[model samples]
Target chain A: MATQASLDNPPQVPSQTSSTGRGFPTGLAVLTGFTGVMLLAASYMVFVYAPMERTLGNVQRIFYFHVASAWAGALAFLVALVAGIVFLINGKMQWDRVGKSSVEVGLMLLTITLTSGPIWGQYAWGNPWPAWDPKLTSAAVTWLSYAAYLMLRQGIDDPRRRARFAAIYVIIAFTSVIFTYVGVRFVEQTIHPHVVGPSASTGEGDFGVSARIGQTLGFSLLTFTAVYATLLAHRLRLENLSERIKQVKSAVLARQG
Target chain B: MTDRVEAETAQSTRRTLKPTPLAQATLAIAWKDLRSELRRRELVAAMLVFALLSLLIFSFALEVDARSRAANAAGILWVTLVFAGTLGLGRSLGRERDQGSLEGVLLAPIDRSALYFGKLIGNFLFMIIVAVIIIGPLSVLFGISLFTPLLPLILLLGILGYAGVGTLVASLAAYTRGREILMPILLLPIALSILIPAVRATRAVLEGAAYSDITIWLNLLLATNVVYIVLAYLLFDFIVSE
Candidate 1:
């Protein structure tokens, strides 16, 4: 059993050095550059190409990036959920790293979604914060849930135990994400419009998306996915470096003693 | 030698065929908690007094007249329950940690799910007792009779859901450095999903709405209760494991 445990978690020194020496792989750099260009193009399409809506006019352009960010946030959370489950099942530190990094990025993107949502709401619905909006409320709730997950992580000291608790928590928190996406529709009345699915309702401030607008939305979502991937890779590398530093510091202290 | 081997095989087979010890362990743990509570009366007293005081504060803050109180009764009831229930939950687990009894419990030869369900039952019972105590004062103070049979049923479903998630979260929080402060922060957002439907159902029942009108919320409450209980049961082992 001891031999198996050691073999499973072989000394981390060589791999860390080799990866760090490579210093930012070409793939990631290319992906980041591609994402930057696509994001710029998407913005141009939103401003110059898509026709102005008769209802909300040019302010409706925010919907393209706003909805794209929401989608990306949900997708990131889903990645965290999957990674969490895998970590719990396999007890792998790499999976935990993936889960934590994804959650951080997801939380940042969701903040953008939540903030942009109100700006759009103010111009479109004439209320900066519509109390009865189901989508808005659900987004707020999901954001709080993940924020709690991060806070819980901060309070635990043992890396293994922290990862374990976070794994269980993110899995549980994913249910709230699902609820935010679908639960509002179950309530009797909601002012938030459903842009997709069979139960899409034309609520206040909803406008028809022309073909050009749809293209822009799709392009923006794809660009955000690329950005999410690049960010997650960089965050994972940072965590590995930090872990390596801790190991080296402990080894040096032992030698000095 | 053959006779002895045959006898050993028979005993091992009989042991394998017997029912698991899970049910008995769950009951024993729950009974132990209740008996301890009966002797000390600590958790229940705090929860009850805190709940009553919350009602007092809400009344003053809202300046709730009889009509307005009636309208806000459901929201008031759930808010009071959540705050009081959180207090009870934190104290209940915090005691085990403070006394170092949690380690002993884990060391016992029992399944972890049994420990989880045991805590769930104990927490559920405490919340229900507090809810029952608050009903009388709520009735007299708000000038509305809140003693309907349906009200208790709704409270039971709601408290079950709350306690299901609460017991698991409390155990997790109890291990943290900021156990007391972290419990509510971790609990409230997740519990909100359960509380929303519960508050809706309670309001419908309070207003004497038709059964059909409130059925959906009741169903939601039941679903949330079962989902949380099962999920917590399956996941408790992970949280408690080293």
Candidate 2:
């Protein structure tokens, strides 16, 4: 349990060097810059380069970022799932950190996918929210599953036990994410567009993709993937720093006693 | 004290008893739970009452036209079963935690997964009992026929998957604060995967859809059961570790 004294009197983070005695890596900086540039270019391609749909017109442009963010969200969860397995096998705290950070990033990206999805859906489906669509319902379920993952983490105070329990949970929760991405496509009743390969012919929002739209979709995916990586790296660093601060605080408490 | 004598005799029997095989150990734990429940009769009774009460509410909540009743039957039954199942799961595990028996169970010579399977079996049986008892009233109240040959098979698979995951999660929640409330929050979303298909399959069965039409859902329910049971087997040890 965290004591009120330690909570109120927090340790100051060293400005120049981390507890590792290192500054930010050049590789991360370069990746950050590259992601920024790619994001700008991807936006240009989405709004300017990709041709407006024959029917959906300008509203169809949301598809590029929508699918890209969803792709990034799924990728982040995949990373967490792998991190969870490794953490359980090796009992490594760093792997636990990676798993936690990835889920946080994944949840953020999923929120974007879910919220932006409804906006486009309002125009494409004439309903901002369609409860019957398997794609949307499963995505909501996936979101709730990960949200519960965070709540589970919050309820446990022991670090190692928390990490172990979280690893077990995140791995189990990945099923919902898989269902959202792949399993729902098998359902014949969903009206959500299946932009990927051959889907059931029953979807109402299905559209034909042209050459430029495909290019922009690909670039947006790359940019969002980069964004996921950048956010995860920064979140991991923050986690590491907070862990160090806890160590220092506990040491100070022992000295005072 | 008589309590000390009981503990001493229990320890003596354990010393005389050799380590049982995994299946035997699992059955012993499951039987212990069943025997205890049989004597007390509270857990299943509460669950049965809850299940029937919800059925009563649903009969009025949905328009009870003969046509709509069949259409609404599947959803109402699953929802009733899941809520009742959650209540039963929480109580079963909460009893172990409250009595400090889980630690004693953990100290046994059996494998951790034996403990998991034991609890799963007990929970599965409770769910089956409540599910069976509810169907009679549900059919009578809704004025529909539900005695199809295949319905029990679907109920078995669905409850297997539900109880498998529910036991694992209830154990997790048992150690936390306000575990009573936390049980449903953590369990329900993951349960959606299982419940949706169960409801769909049941709807098809009720509507007299061909076996061909229902095979997809039945297959999915079986696959989910296999996955959850395997995952629970692999992961249960981590939860029980000191």
Candidate 3:
């Protein structure tokens, strides 16, 4: 139906003033403001509220935001995977847009988690990048897989075909995300901290979570998730605007001819 | 038409053979590839020569003593296998695209996944042939014992997973521009799950580690193999669809 509609009605360029005057939607703007406030509160909890960790000192504070970013990154990737499956089933460009946007958000979050991880590692273990560590290796694999997902998206010219192939790739690439986050626990040894449920026997940097620390980490996770939501909403808006601009350009070229 | 006559004849032959239609179609596609390959002798030869050359480069670059070669050998072998396998996958699918035969194959009445599994089988066979041939030179050049009983099993599992994913990704990449470069970029990251366990299993087997130790990596390899193959099977239809 959308393809038919676009075929029938050639796009028209909006007035320059109207295009530039478009304001943020009320709901998204509110969410963005709320997320901003929560981020500030979470930062306070990380720096001042949570007690300094005994052994690792202030560097352990990075754990709160670092783990939270990792959680948000995984959630973004999960969103991409679900959106992909939905796009394949229903053949909707909306889900494809959501899927690609989520990957961009996920890649951004993963960059933060990965880069901050080494900072903590440098402080604690005196090694910034541990080459053979299973956790690090798997995390890198996850990052590269999504990066490839974007490359796959770029290579296709047809929107329908791009969406279809990208959806398939998203499904395949999520396995790497699963492996990085969950499967690494099965490996024999990792110097990375596993603070959640049951820390592995040979896991380094294991720490006891006091109530205050747990509360901060919880708040940080909530804030980061909200951040993911806000970022995804903004990304979708940007994509829709770009689509309109492309349609307008094509229409102009056709009229000139 | 001759096409109709051949189709009817093949149909009768398949009915007599009594395999499921999917299996019949799969084997026919694979046999078609193998038969052509037998005549041309191109894909496997290129892969084998590339594998050996990479093997040579590994030995020269590492320049390790015999003791360390045993350790480095698994990494070297898997890397060569991955690179050479990519070569074969690109060519095998690229050939079908360039010759415009893939469209004809799609025009057949078989399920699309039959095409995937067929290509996967053909690629898997080519990789196995290359791997088996390269083992002699690998052991001789690296001066390591690759003759363990478990080595073939490891090679089978590793190549099975590699070719399974490779065939699917190759099809996905073929429609895109610059497929030669794009295939490895799309494949190698996903193949790491297969390669990591594979290299570890090969290393464990080389060191004569206890059976229990190597079983873990073997099982991981098997699990990833099942995952990739099933994913490829379910997803291949959308890839080949118009």
**Best-fitting candidate, scored by DockQ:** 3
Can you write out model 1's per-residue Cα lDDT over A99-194, one digit (the tens) per residue? 999999999889889988888888888898877466777788889999999888988899999998998888777775554346535755777776
For candidate 2, give the docking quality class from DockQ. Answer: medium
In model 2, pairs of residues that clash are none
What tens-digit string does per-residue lDDT give for candidate 3 at B148-170? 99999999999999999889889
Candidate 1 residue lDDT tens string, B118-218: 88889999999999999888787677788887887899899999999889888888878788888898888888878887888888888888998688888
Ranked by TM-score from best down, the candidates are 2, 1, 3
Candidate 1 error regions (>4 Å): A1-18, A199-202, A254-257, B1-20, B65-71
Flag regions of model 3 displaced more than 4 Å: A1-21, A246-257, B1-20
For residue B123, what is the lDDT in candidate 2? 96
Deviation in Å, model 1, residue A91 alpha carbon: 0.2
lDDT of 2 by residue, B183-237 (tens): 8988999888888778889999999988886888888778788888899999989
Worst 10 residues of 1 chain A by lDDT: A9-18
What digit string (tens of lDDT, one per residue) describes model 2 on residues A92-164?
Answer: 8889999999999999999999999999989888999987678888888888998998898888888999899
Whole-structure CA lDDT of model 1: 0.80
Residues A1-257 of candidate 3: C-alpha lDDT, one tens digit per residue = 65456656765665432234267678878999999999999999999999999999999999999999999998999999999999999998879999999999999999999999999999888898887788788888889999999999899999999999999999988875565446545854777777666776665677888999999999999999999999999998888778777767677667655
Which 10 consecutive positions of candidate 3 chain B have the poorest summed lDDT? Answer: B1-10
Instruction: Compute each candidate's TM-score over C-alphas.
Output: 0.91, 0.92, 0.90
Q: Ranking under DockQ, best-scoring first?
A: 3, 2, 1
